[model samples]
Target: MVSLRKVPGAHQHPNLPGKVKVEEDVNSKAVPVDQETMPTIIQTVKEDLGELKKFYNITLSPTRFQKVEHYLEKKLEELSNITFGKLNQAGQVDYALLNNYLKSSLQRLRSDKVKDDEVLKLVGSFAFIIIELFEARQRIQKLDFQEVAALFTRADNSARDLKQAISSGIFRGKIERTIAYRTAYKLEELSSVLRDWHNFYLGYEPLYSWWVSQPYATFQENLSILIACIQTDLVGFDDSVKDPIIGEPIGRDGILADLDFEKIAYSPEELIHIGEMEYQWCEVEAKKASCEMGYGSDWRKALEHVKNMYVGPGQQIYGIHDLAIEATNYVKDHDLVTVPEIAETWRMLMISPERQKANPFFLGGNTMQVSYPTDKMSHEDKLMSMRGNSIPLSRSTVFHELIPGHHLQFHMIKRHRPYRRIFDTPFWMEGWALYWEFILWDKGFPGTPENRIGMLFWRMHRCARIIFSIKFHLGEMTPQECIDFLVDKVGHERATATGEVRRSFNGDYSPLYQAGYMLGALQLYALRAEVLQSGQMTEKEFHDKVLHENEMPIEVLRALVRNFPIDPDFRPSWKFYEKN
Candidate 1:
């Protein structure tokens, strides 16, 4: 059955988020039940944490933090008791994933607490007062309405006073100002939490309402005003410039930790080098395409020409539909992978002007959303939209969104070992879609030189993402620098480049999300070569096997596909790609 699910700590706009899995009729004798790989303890811990998180909803609640930490520690001890060597291959994979998940969760909780403390230092005791109220309410303690009302008054006055200090140049340094801005956002969340708690008892308990209603309203208003003040005065961002790219650079250590969590065998520098190497290959191929297009060696000119090849106004959707059909037929004819008829059936929708700010391209699953000019857009914006979603560019990725990309990926995952969905990584999800682009390009799917350029352009963009995103997280690249890199290096439209950088650093995505596209594709590409060379599986079987295995780190997937022995203490040691 279809159901709404929350990915724990999923805070970003994913590459292809929100695809509803169509239920499979497993009652049919033809449908075989997939083997269960997830260990019982892993499932139990996942379920327990999901429940605990629902009740402990407050972000900065000390009680919630303590309980989660203790719970994780207990779970770790229980997991350690399992016999790792006795488990089957899939069971071993699950064990490793569970161990990593438990450790990573603990690390994240501790890290979040450190950040919360830093933000609290800037925000003051007022935030803690609001947190205390939520905690007390959750405890079902008898309300001391007058005392609680007095606390709200103190919080409101203190919040207003803090705003005045910030206005008077209290936080002058850039780092201090950044912290203040973060505190402002944290206070905004606190304001919402307080409002929820306030509404819970607002009119339900007459005594509480009489004593606390006005104070609660006053405190909430003061919190909003403070948030606005921090945004406008400290951060210099108002409504007109609402989406300023103020990303939190996780630094080198953070990047290293993230790499470990993703089970990536390479170091941050090595990954960037891989990106650069791949980018250089794209550049060489792009020059060849440019030459064929009569643009000499200057690929930028070739890119501009390709961009201007947009279909007539109001005809973008039909072009997309035709491309989807073409791509689906080509894959089926080639026997690349099985495409269920249902995967080909997708409804079309137009992206809103606002969403186009972050995702200025196509997104697909059960529904394919097209990005093109609308009547509400300005002339310049409309032109940019059309240019960005040109026929050539769209052709390169039509299959990436539909058919062998997101649509097929989502369809197969549901019918397979769906319980492993919790272990999903962008490296597999986005990487699988991106890998098709590589294979199709190798098979000469990009027919014309302009089409080749289109494919190369996205390949170059993916490589650039790896560079800029990794560098940005490692504190080597600023958001503005990243935008400039895309524009100057990858031949991106200035507006499109800006949107990309904004999306990358807006804390909506994990640090390595952008890098996942190309790097992930490379991982899969290497695996395919290994599998084929060893005669382990034919081409079609290799492709189909991946989808049925559901989502995991590519490294983990590699171990599964290759039938390598996995241990409970498994560390990522597979260097899938070697530098040429």
Candidate 2:
């Protein structure tokens, strides 16, 4: 992994009002600044910015940098009245000030250089810092006990909101294009920072060693709670549709042709088989845990309690009694994919508790770390552990979090070199994951009525998430109201609902899952039709091409489709698809 160097301190910005001077007599380094020399700050800022622009080669022309300098200068002038104490002492960096600085800088660049790519990239970098400041403020706000439990939840939601804004804004196109050009560079920077954070705070190796080694149980408990919260809240919630063909048992010719699955260095059938075994293993573990925890004499009671506790009224909860019947019926009625690729992938990845603890983002109550292998089984572990009867609601979470969703989307993006930007764009990554839930069903794994209901239950959860995110962030509802709405509308347990509300307060990113899922699916469906009708491609060919090309913005996808050569006899007008 590439690592980014640490950004210099605030005083390092050459444009600041003072310069360090060595005083031999006093044997001290002092910043010398007086009214007479103050004008130099502006010139220095300009010169420094110029150097940065040149170093990055942001554009072939110096004109873009010149424009940015002009705007930055004006912003600094405006901020002159804004005292550092006032801006930074609010316990956080003032985002309003940061936004003003960014806006001014971007506007100036836009006026001078019409290249959307350069302007958007610079804007994105600036926005990243501003977002970090906002997040830091949020973290500080959670210093108290009550707020600490909610911190991770809030961070997850905030990330979703920030990604959504970036995806939907007018700047998305430019940002996407520019990101494609520089994602690797940025990822390197992020990796370095993450390493430092891990070493300094999380402690390397043995998973949560730092957390466990803490002298105070309160601290450990707090960390554990935060981890649990994030895992439950943020890991899996995509709303996009999967390509039925991709999930087929025999594997479609189109999929084969498009992907060198052969080159993936794994067999699809073997993958699915392993997933099934893992699933069964998880079921056994859950039952053992439940029995030990004493949910009831049998696993059935524990399963029931888990369902009633987490599932909302509108969703379906398939009991063990219905499992065999449903499975047999589904196999008989549906064109089931024999490979079980998704299931296999999830089972292999989620069985280890160590893997669960490594991911900080998976801290929430119902996170994939806790839910995946156990959803379909009794809460045996919880029972054996003698903990509360809180079964993970979205137990099939690994399906959404790892294989056939996030993992798949991420790996697919990495496959195509030119479309690497897709990984950088959270919207594409998240939206694609959400869309896969329905797609898996459509491909025939969950075909019985019971299975369908179970699937619908998951969908309802996502829908509720959408409503909650929009209402909560837009101020249409209070945090309490949000909690009530989730419970009343989605049938979530009070504890889960309350967790969701608390999480919402800390961030604004939850809405993107629904929006992206819905929009991305629509785009894929329409694009598929266009490709098919053009007689230039088969379903397999189109899907192969699309997946192989990676997770570009819908607009970019459309452009690529339009440019794809096709037979005149089969050609279809692009007018069929509606833009969001």
Candidate 3:
């Protein structure tokens, strides 16, 4: 989700300033005192790595990969030299995090190299020429306009050849076809780089533009044609279609690699099973709510009733505002978690029709953007948008975006152990918000059957997310299948379902992101059970401790909160979920 700090047309509260105050609250009991040493070397390593990455910003270059790999190797050596016993618990935590990041970065670089190699095979001849031009520009080399023109000419011919070769059916299978589609996008990116390089000297250096203009134009056209051919002929993409989702699954091995990076010990198959189990639970709960709504076992009908309970046009803002106020009051009244004064103040805005395609609901961090029907939308789209952001649905989502969700999290991380910001995982971020939903449900926040159905809708959606997202990445489900699953199983509106599926596999979010909500919340729920149930910490203390620790893998936070002995090479081993 895109975080909006300031919006031009946002409805600003007079009390909430444009610039938020993020200073430490010394008198606040919410924040725990830092008793452990700060890892200064980790900061140094971070800066050094930042400098290295800034210089080698090009994507998928072997030279870039090798240089980065070498840099990480040296950092690993430096990390190994640190004496684990000398550091405090916090320092040891940073050490473990850095170690994990270095190892994961290295593994990802290697994996990327394999994929890049395949992509280059499809676009290498022409891409290499453009890459050299950019590299030379980066080095401040004098432009050889005539030679550049010749190079572009060669690239244009090469692109044409490549397109013809691909169209000849050499790349026929699903795997090869997926690679070809990816190659098309890579060509689009290369064209952008070409445009930037051309615009850099187009007007300033007259001779350079005059000599290279025709060739550049020819090559850009050729690249576009090649890209279109790959999409249309090879990938069977139709431009007439709206929001065509062409997702390439990474398969089980890639999913395993991602899980390893996130310190999740569970297998992808096991996670899907967990999703199924959770879905079954939500179904039972939904049926109970449906019966209370006089709809018997047909929760879908109950869901329809809730959807139609949406506020009228131009009235969504008030409903959303009231929901936020209600959630704020509930959390504060219950002493669920420490609510920062700043988190309580947030600006509200309407998501544009364009952005609504990707984010069809509330998007919050510092600001909450409500998705509602606009004057420009068609009749059907207007109705879909209204139903998707209905009062009952917005009830559960408001707090998830504001208050104890992303909004409070933004302020909390800035105030506490901000350096651990690099180790931030969606499991902690999205999971914490979703965890609040679980807490609220248990605390009877959903007083009405409609509200419970609404809550269950999102809960089941998260479950479906885990199932569809994992299955998609495992090559067992397509994007359309995922959308259908959301509509059929979770009772989402079709347009809303399309947007959710599009955003999931649109390459913006991590493969595990959708799964993170429920899985991450479940981890926290389990920890809450372990801590509060055992009488080690009160509810407020447990919640406060998590916020103070800042962001890291929930498993790491688990070890920290449990006061487990810190080790330099700690890996996540807590099997938080049981099959039964």
> How much is 421 displaced in model 1, in angstroms?
1.2
Superior candidate under lDDT, 2 versus 3: 3
Per-residue CA lDDT of model 3 for 1-580, tens digit only, reads 1111444654332322231222222222221213324455556556767766665566745446766777777777766766777877887788888888888888878877887899987777778777656655564546567767777888888888978976886666644667766777777777888898888878887777788899999889888989988887777788788658977788899999888878889999999999999999999999999999999999999999999998987899998899999998888999988997766788998899999998998899889999998999999999999999899998889999998889989988888887787776889999999999999999999999999999999999999999999999999998889989999999999999999999998778988899999999999999999999789999999998999888888888888888788767676688999756
C-alpha TM-score for every candidate:
0.90, 0.39, 0.91
User: In model 1, which residue pairs have backbone atoms overlapping below 3 Å?
Assistant: 12-508
Residue 496 in candidate 1, Cα distance off native in Å: 1.2
RMSD of 3: 11.0
In candidate 2, which residue ranges exceed 4 Å CA deviation?
1-368, 372-396, 501-505, 508-514, 533-536, 564-580
lDDT of 1 by residue, 1-580 (tens): 1112333453212211222222222122221112333545556676777877777787776656877887888767766766677778888888888788889889989988888788877675687677656755664546567767777888889889988987887665644545656777787788888888988888788878888899988988888888988887787676876577777777788888878888898899999999999999999999999999999999999999999999978999999999999999999999999988777778999999999888888888878999888899999998898999999999967889888998899899888877677777889989999999999999999989999999999999999999999998887887889999999998888788988998888778888899999889999999999999999999999999999988888888899999988767668888877777
Alpha-carbon lDDT, every model: 0.82, 0.38, 0.82
Using TM-score, give the best candidate's number. Answer: 3
Candidate 2's TM-score? 0.39
**Alpha carbon deviation, residue 112, candidate 2 (Å):** 23
